[model samples]
Target chain A: MKRIFKIYTPFINAGMQETATYRVNWVFYILGSVLGCFVSYFIWHAVFLSGSGETMNGFSLPQMIVYIFLIFLTSTMIGSDAAWAVGEEVRDGSIAMRLIKPVSYNATFLFQELGNKLLTEMFLVVPLIAGLEIVRTVIVGRVEFSVVNLLIYLCSCVLAYLINFFFNICFGFLAFVIKYLWGANMMKNCIVGFLSGAIIPLSFLPETLGRIFMLLPFASLNYTPVMIYMGVYQGTELLYYIGLQVFWALFFFGLSKLLWVVSVRRLSVQGG
Target chain B: MKHIRRLFRIHRIFVVQELKRMMEYKGDFIVGVIGFLMVQCSNLLFLWIIFNNIPNLLGWSLNEVVFIYGFSLIPKGIDHLFFDNLWAIGHFTVRKGDFDKYLTRPVNTLVHVLFEKLQIDALGELIMGIALVCVSLPQLQIEWSVFKVLLGIAAVFFATFIFTGIKIITASVAFWKKRSGNIIYMVYMFNDFAKYPVTIYNEVIKNLITYIIPFAFTAYFPALYLLTGENPLYNVGMTVLMSLALMSLGVFVWHRGIRAYESAGS
Candidate 1:
């Protein structure tokens, strides 16, 4: 583990600096997210108005509002352009040059994506959450967030990040065979956006479907952490959720390692 | 008259060239359509999920809300299909000095820029919009007439121009800033607000959409007008006025931006 960390630390640093170079995009990124926040607010506000002035399923209006912001926060952490980057590199044959480098490709991408996520969390997501929370408080009355829940939420997020990154690398590896992941990438995002509970809370779904989704790895992405943040899980239940994240994290990482080996062999460049 | 005719003739030639290029990537096109269709379906699913819990959104029924949602997509899809090349300007055309190609051409630069490519992925949104409208029209139960049908068609046609006008104005910022993709994105995403009933928004946001960005006229107003027979002058008429105003502003900006443009030193 130390050896792997030693190998990838510089790459992670490089990735962080590379992302920081595009800091002009930071303002617009924040602005775009504000719109998303408003959309959530309006939609949920309307839903609450239309229904009985009480909690739907288990989430109160305030909880749902907070859930939306937490979704934004978690999505920011889990989201990475590394897969899209990999697809582009693979398509353009840049991966061929990287192949000769005496390091692990998947590990390099894994850490680099971590670096990107860290930078975004620092410069964009964290600050936006602070701002959104104030707005969230003013609009929907403050819902208590316990310290224990926040800590567990952060821990679950780390595990979720691993699961998300490995899944992306595995998905990106498809380009080595298919040569373009544009459509596949879109399909992946569209599906993930909903399934990861970014679109709406999974608990809002029918009970059976909700239970089934919790078993799926995608739940570890945004749903678990947000649920934890909302204090929906505690004690043994919280530990179980964390265990699920750990299990999926390991599963996806293994899947990515296997795919990486095959992908390197399958890599082919079209035209000079 | 002759200049307009020449530009139209040239646009046709460019479009034909684009169609031929599109033919080379049949697989990409199909996958893109399917992918976008799925994307739209997911949004539809969100609305469906919400409605499952409740019967209406701001007194707008599921079908009525879906009607606006679907109506919003049509103008968006139209702009996406034809004017997507404009995205390049805001994204990288100015930064990469690709805009020079437009200037060096014999044809008008704006015309050349616009006619350069046709984005096929937008067909999914177009097809989804049409399908949604057709499916929901029966459920909506609006008093229909030949005049209303023709008026709706005109409203939709003008709405497409509103999208193009906004895109053009936003994209022209690249000439001055070298990269205005983010600005364009921030402005363009306001259209999402337009997809829902504007009444759901607070007074501030309602005014913001109607006056500043004018996206309210794109879908919500026209949909409201069509369904409820509200002020024709305010709804459809404002749509026409906004489109014309935006188009003029777009053209004016493009010209001003062209003068200010400085290519990257190669």
Candidate 2:
């Protein structure tokens, strides 16, 4: 464990330094996201006002508001764009330098992501969540989140992050073939944003469509974590969703490992 | 007249150069168009899902909402198609000292920058907008006449300038800051607010879109005028007036930024 820790520390430090250099990006990213949140808020508020039901899709107006904000918070914590980073290294032929190093390229990024998130969460993300919680409290008339759910929510977030990171790492492997992944990246973001219920809850979608999406692992990324936080799933049901997250995380991990070996072999053969 | 003709001739030359360059990246272009199409499709899916839960939003039917959404895209896509290179100026041109090349050119600098690239990927947005407007047309309650048609066309044409103007003003900030893509992104994204019924929002946001950024004049106001025939002078006229004001402001800022441009120091 000590040796493992030592191996990852430098990459983590490098990631934090890289992120620190782009402090301005963090601000504008949050601003754009907050604007998206407000747009969702007003649209949903309008929907509630027009509808006769007190609850639609099993969420009250207050719960729906919390759901929207929590989606933003959780997705920010868990979402990965490792594909873009990996694709860039490949494009500039810097992957060869990375390969020569003793470190595991994919594993190092996890530590780097840790470093990136540590800085972001400690400074930007935590403060934003606190501010949102205050807004949520003002809107809902009380601070009502269960403390137990928060603990479990954190655990689920770990698995969700791993799942997302592996998925994007797989996309990064595509850089071996595609050369430019900009369009593919855009498509991935939209599809994931929709499927993961970051834009809207899956329950609000058509029942069959929602069910089909759940059959994939995207819902586990954002939806499952928020639902756990809201205490919508309990006991065995909660365990079931968390187990599903583990399954997807492992599946993507194996797939990415297979791709890494194949791609690296191809790389050496072509380089010679 | 001669100067304008010369500018057009130069613009044509640059466009041909860009088209030749585009042949090398045909696959990327196709993928970009498909990517945009998917985004629009998913957005419409989101809209559909919302309407599934509620009968109407802010007393406006889904078809009416769709009309406004589609109308907003026309101007946005037009601006995206022609002025995408503005993004590079905001993003890295000033930061990397590439702005020096534009200044040294003999042609009008602002015109030169704009004529440098044409992004064909926005064809997806343009086509989707026209498709949505047509799909929603039969259900809308608008009374169409030759005069109204002409007014609508003119409103959309001028509304395109609103997007271009906002992009220019924000992008020109790069001259001083070395990069202003985020500023442009922040301001340009306000157009999303106008894609829906502006009245559905809080008073503050409604006023923000209408007066502060004036993005509402690009879509909701013009759509509202056509749908309900309330006041063309207020809807269509304000759009034209705002476009004129914004463009003059845009050009003034670009010139000011030109004077301020210090190439990024090594």
Candidate 3:
């Protein structure tokens, strides 16, 4: 047990170091996220206007605005392009060093990815969210905040992050089979973009599609948490959604572990 | 004249090689194309949902928006298929030190870099875009004139030029900043806004899009010319002229940006 801790400590320390190094780039990310949110804001504002005076699918103009702002924040917070890591390392012959590490590469990758992601969200996404509120006040008036709702939203966001991390790691493991994993990852992005209700609200979706999507892991990433925050799903249903996120996270993490086991074995034997 | 002819020939050869390479992984290629088409289909699907709920959005009917979506793809798809390498320019040239090799080459660096890889996978998006225009034709209420048809095609090309130019400019920013690839993220954040009709936006925004960014010409202005019988600025000719001017301006900016290039990793 002490031996394991000794190995893991250095890996965790390295992740902390990388976070510190990349911390300066967080400003660009904040600006980019803010710009992205502004685009979504314009799109939703136009959409709401066309829906006549009536609020389509129970989303008031304010609710729609808030939902889109959160969607931008959540995707920026959780989304990772880690799928390309394995392919690049393998092709470039850097996987050898990873294999020789005292700690498990998968564990290092997971912990490091989480550390980097947390820093990105804190420094970048938080500022953008704050900026959005400031811009909103100037453009459309004041925003109402609820402490209870914020706590629930944060919980859902954590669950969503784990789900995103698991699925993206699964995509990375595909490098064992495919030479270039970009196409596979791009396909994943498209699915997440559409089904997650990031681009369009799930409430605006047809009843059947909305219900089906809400059950999926993709929805947990951006849609469900944002929806819950905007009060789209209430009470018991919100709890159910959060529970499903937990189930999906555990399920995907397990699958990823299995895939990692097979992939590493293949890598070792095939001399990847 | 002879050198120009030779350059064109080399470009054709490069494109053919790329096509052959794409053909090697026929199954993966097909899957990729299908997946891209599905994503494009979802864009249409979103429009369908909106039209079903509200019937029209800021004077754009389901068919008109469909037409705009379809034609907009022409420029975007062409850029993707022909100039996909340009999208990676910032990373490849600056961060990866790949630009060092490009500068050493005798021929024009821009031409070679722009055509390095062709995403034939985007052919799916291109076909869908054309099919969309065809599908909307019968459903479309407005009469199609020969002049309008010419203008439409011109506008699509112009939009492609603008899109490619934007990518080039942003990608070139890698010269000054590490991981300038983030600029693509920023561009995507803004570019997707062009998908909707600009009429829905307030005057300030509409003017910003029209004059500053020229995103309005990409789909909105040309789309308005198609949908409404009367053009905002008289005839389609004027709109086409403006689009050409924007495309030229984009090319000019790209050229200026290229000249400002300082290779990474001194």
Candidate 4:
């Protein structure tokens, strides 16, 4: 493990440098996300205001706003362009270079992604959340935050990140056979955007659909952590949610490993 | 007249070449279409889910909202189909110093660049948009008349110009920034706000969409004029005026950008 860390640390540093080089781009990305959150907040605010009741599916206007805010935070941590990077490399026949490396390709990629994620969390997510918290306090008053819930939310967020990474890598492996993954990437984004509750809360979905989404791994992506932070699930239910996240993380990781093997074999057969 | 005819001929040739190239990668083409369709379907599904819970959003029924959503796509699809190469300006061409090629070309640089590539995926959006409009037309209970048909066509035509104009202005920012894709993307995200009734939003958002960015002229205003048949002249007039204003601004910016252009590599 120490040796692996030693090998990957430089790559992570390189990734951090690359991210720093595009600091202006990150500014625009964060700005766009903030604008998106405002738009969503206003839309839901209108809906709640239009209705007779202040709550929709047990989400008050402020809670919904907070939920959107949390979704953006978790999304920044979990969302990685690793799939697109991998897809490009595979399409261009550059995966062979990585395959020839002494280090495991997945480990190098994961470490680099982790480095980028760490930078983004610090520079983008943390500051944005702080700003939003200030706004929330000014507008909606005090928000409930417990140490136990925060700890569990953090753990669930880590699991969500892993699940997302493995899912992206799985899609990246498809580039071995499919020359263009742009379409597949778009479709995957749409599916994940809806099923993962990034665009809308899963609870707002029809009951059967919401239940189905809960069963799927995608629900853990943004929904589970945000819900946990909201204290929607507690006690044994919270434990079960955490367990489900772990199960998905392990499942996707194994599936991606199997896919990598098959894809590498295919590449070798094709003289890649 | 002669220059316009020549430009049209060149555009046709470029489009034909793009189509041939797209056909070479049939799988990619099909997948692109499917991907766009999936995105459109998901958006419609979102609307369905929302409407299932609420009977109306600001007095707009499900069918009415769907009509607006569908109408919004026509202009967006047209812009995507033809002007997608503008994205390359912000993303690659300016950054890589490839804008020099457009300057050297014999044809009008803007025309040549705009027609350089066609996004076939937009055909999927076009099909879906028309299908949605058709499915909702009967339910909308609006009397089909020759004038209304002409008005709708005009609305779509002007809306496409508005979309293209915005894209051009955004892409032209590459002259100053060298890489302005993110800015372009951020600005483009405002189009999402235009998909619903403008009345649903607060005064600030409404004015922002109407006067500042003017996306409401692309969808909501036209749909309002078409559906309710109230203030038809005002809505359609604003659409036309906005289209002309935006297009002129786009051309003006493009010229300024060309003058400001310094190739990337020294």
Identify the leading candidate in terms of lDDT. 2
B3-72 per-residue lDDT for model 2 (tens digits)? 9999999989988998998889999888888889899989899999888878788789999999999998
Kindly give the stretch of ten consecutive residues in candidate 2 chain A with the minimal lDDT sum. Answer: A263-272
lDDT on C-alpha atoms for all candidate structures: 0.86, 0.88, 0.73, 0.86
**Which prediction has more favorable DockQ, 1 or 3?**
1
Q: Write the per-residue lDDT of candidate 1 for residues A126-223, one digit (tens) a residue.
A: 57556756766786666464667777888888988888888888888877767448987999998888888888889888899988888998888999
TM-score for the B chain of model 1: 0.97
What are the per-residue Cα lDDT tens digits for candidate 2 across A1-272? 99989989998999899889887967776676678778888888899999999999898888888888889888888968699988887777778888888988899878999898888866755676577678778977888757798789888998999999999999998988985599889888999999999877999877898889986889989999999988899999998999999999999999999999998876632252
**lDDT, candidate 4, A1-272, per-residue tens:** 89878999998898898889888987886776677777777667767766777788888877888898899888878887778988988777777788888988888889988888778777765576567667767777675646676678878999999999988999898888788799889989989988989888888887898999999999988899999987899899998989999999999999999998888777742354
lDDT tens digits, residue span B116-148, model 1: 889899999999999998889998779988877
Model 3 misplacement above 4 A: A1-36, A90-93, A131-143, A231-238, A268-272, B176-179, B229-266
Q: Residue B89 of candidate 2: its Cα lDDT?
A: 93
iRMSD in angstroms, per model: 1.2, 1.4, 2.8, 1.6
Scanning candidate 1 chain A in windows of ten residues, the lowest lDDT window is A139-148
**lDDT score at residue B198, model 1, on the 0-100 scale:** 92
State the lDDT at B105 in candidate 4. 79
